[model samples]
Target: MESTNNIIEIKIDSYDDLVNHIKGKTDKCGDLRDNFIFRGLSNFEHELVPSALRKDNLNQPIVNDYVGGDLGLLVLISNEDVKSNFLEDRVHIDLGYGKWVSFDKNQHPFFDNNREYLKNKNYLQIKRETYALLKFLNIADKNGLKINTSYETRSKIHNYLNPDKITFWPKKSFFEIISLAQHYNLPTCALDWTYDYHVALYFAVKDILENKNNDGVIWALNYRLFEDNYNESNEYKLRFYRPEYHSNPNLRAQKGLFTFLINPVDEILDCPLDQVICREIKNIGKKNKKTVFDNGKDLILIPPEITENDIIFYKFVISKNAKLDILEELYKEGYSEDTLFPGYGRVIQNMGNRVMLENIKNESDKKPKKNILLKIKNCEDIFQRKINYLFGKFNFNSEIENIYIYSPESQEIKGYFKANEIIKNSPNLIWEKYHNKSNWLKKDFNNYFKDNKAYAIRINGLIEFNFPFKINNLSMGNQFMYIEPDNTDINFLLNFK
Candidate 1:
């Protein structure tokens, strides 16, 4: 353990070590559980800055980039009269360059062909635009209104749009609107933290299972320090806010709250909130008398008088190898995606994590099967297009075989298809569908020579797995790479009914 910049950094190698260190801290603090809050980051390199405050190149049209991705549909308001009326003053025409779109009241175009338009707007404008969009969607959902668009586009984005011209807005407060947006994953300045340390630990190690190169970190904050010195007039003060959880079941289940910097000033731009808090504490300590502490066995000793210099923030760095074990332990304790996020949509979104845990729980009874793992790109989109099984050119000697379809985006085995029949050329119906809709498939088809024949493996049925699995010695560059499944991988494949 090392104390630097008023933050105590502790290295934890195992789940037991993490629990014990947290226990020791609580015991030393006289078990004031409510005074402490914890937040977890899957990557140790990530800072405590909010999504809106981060200095990243996010210069894309908000409606087409952010909202379209979530809704899984593109927005193309083709009605010329309607587009002209709504976008007359709101948008600037860029002609041959990329489309021009406005988000805030100032009507500043967020994107251009060169991607330099975002620099004109400040962070506050971006934040305001995000909040406005969320508020409009919330009101639209409440009123059961749909955006006027094509049937497919409307169906996809119907959950968050209102096309009717209305002057009235909802009665909800500003913070309440942004809070709901933050909970639903729309970026906001409020940073999520949980009262339950185990929940924090679960988030910290959740993503490390698939990508094991980076260590996870849990940020334990002693809120008592901030609460004791909280001032309403202080512009740089950091305060915690807990909205009413009666309407938010996920927040209630996770025991979550948010820590918000009162005012994100120019001086603190791109600075981590933890570092800012530590700097403020150090300044406060300079005004008061200092007390020396004894550092024995790398454990920080707190002085009898709780001063600003005391260890208020703790960063627990957990080893990457312990991620799977920690997730298994957390699963047994009922901290899972289903429990933490109570919704059908959320369950589908986190199906990969859920399947990984399911495989871990049912690892005892399993038999290894002769299976080939087939890596595929855009599996989700492919499934959405009603393509049940994948057909590609492969070199195989077997007449019948089990195939596991893997998606690189989810970093998991999406599903399985049993192939038994082989065709010399692409099937007429499937080829027609792909040629009309899928550009990548059409490109592949055009690249093949007339003499070099292609084979299509027809399958009996498709079974969706949607779980995370790591494959050793598998090259991502190969489209149809075959590998022998280990015991764990075999167990996972056998469980795929």
Candidate 2:
């Protein structure tokens, strides 16, 4: 364990070590896995669990001591320590003239049909684009859109856009436009965050299960503490801005919040560049020590603050052995891909993770069948699409297999039907817990399936069932399925051919 710049690093060999360490800090009793409130750094003794090793009883002064001080923990549960700065959004943009870069608040970015321009060098073009963007924002604000115009400079922009000269204005708000741009993957400085820590953990470890040789991490930060620091002298150490969230389903499903970086030119100016770009920049810097780009063109940098030593930042490194337990715990807590990401795209990615993790859980099965039950527990709309596609491709028939559909939401059997029964009377098999009778055979039947409303599928399918919608849509929501059979009574069916 070491401390630098007020940030403490506790290097644990395993997850138990971390849990035990956290346990040793508090005076509470019970398992280390029990949920405990991670409050501010002022008297964690009463709140910390695993009462036996409370602060008074501990034999050593270690990293845990900071938990009760002015320090707050921003845990990143990764196999490796993260090097990216706190404000880095990890997005790059195509800034024409063969120059692509991430957002730099110190400069304006604009482009024309013939070429692109950066604000630091191309004042005329940047000014024109800024005026256009501000005009749009003003129009949006006048139409009741929530644009943050509290800045005194906005009054000048409003005057510049003077209503008398305006012929037409778009109705969408500034937030909506930025959100849409972000949704489509345009280079924007909006870094994504979530209110749920479990969701953060899910992302951190989602890919860890596949590559066991590598470790993963979850980063926890005390933004409030960070704000206090950034606001201390008002000298502008770092500019952090959170956007107003709207009705974007993906953002809502992920519990996402956006934080934009403004004027990070100085904070990140001397920070190391990305490895791929580092070599190129080093070559250019060696030739001209003062300016890397031609004509004094420079890029804005951000995010070193998150990894640096700070009371507001902390991270937890997750080892390979501890990854599964943490992932399973999160799954039980309902932090799977579907819960964090609502669409079919995320559902499928979550399904892949589920399969990998499921295989890890069932590695010791005594009697593994050639065809394991592709069962999905706590099914959602996306999972339903997956099952439909699987049944269609495999020709799953009710007569040969026992198709059990149950509503964990209502704890009732939606129906148990034979494969042929679905073909004969498809409406009878409708799970009213989600979709109603009107949607049983409709084209959009799958669209109505409620998310996170637990449903279960426990049988194999043949390649003859005609399911609506392409199989690709199945990959969107919470996808958890297993191959080894559970206690559910059913003759799993699959076409041998």
Find the candidate with the highest lDDT and give its number. Answer: 1
lDDT of 2 by residue, 1-497 (tens): 45534333443333334444444431112222222212111111122121111223444212132122211111111222112222222223322332233222222221112322233322221222234445455565679865544454355554542212211111123334444344434323234445555565565555556564545543334455444434222222123333454555556665555433322222222121122122333344234222122223332222233333334333445555446666777777777877765778878887887778888767723333232223223435423544442212122222234443433443322333333222211111233322432224544444433221212233334333333112222221222222235523322322311
Candidate 2: segments with Cα more than 4 A from true spot: 12-185, 228-237, 264-310, 344-352, 364-497
Q: Which stretches of candidate 1 lie over 4 Å from their true place?
A: 25-32, 55-64, 67-173, 209-212, 231-236, 264-268, 284-308, 344-355, 358-497
Clash count of each predicted structure: 0, 39
Estimate, for each residue in 85-121, the C-alpha lDDT of model 1 and write its tens digit. Answer: 4543434334433334443322333322222223323
Local lDDT at 335 for model 2: 79
| lDDT, model 2, position 447 | 41
Best by TM-score: 1
Residue pair clashes in candidate 1: none
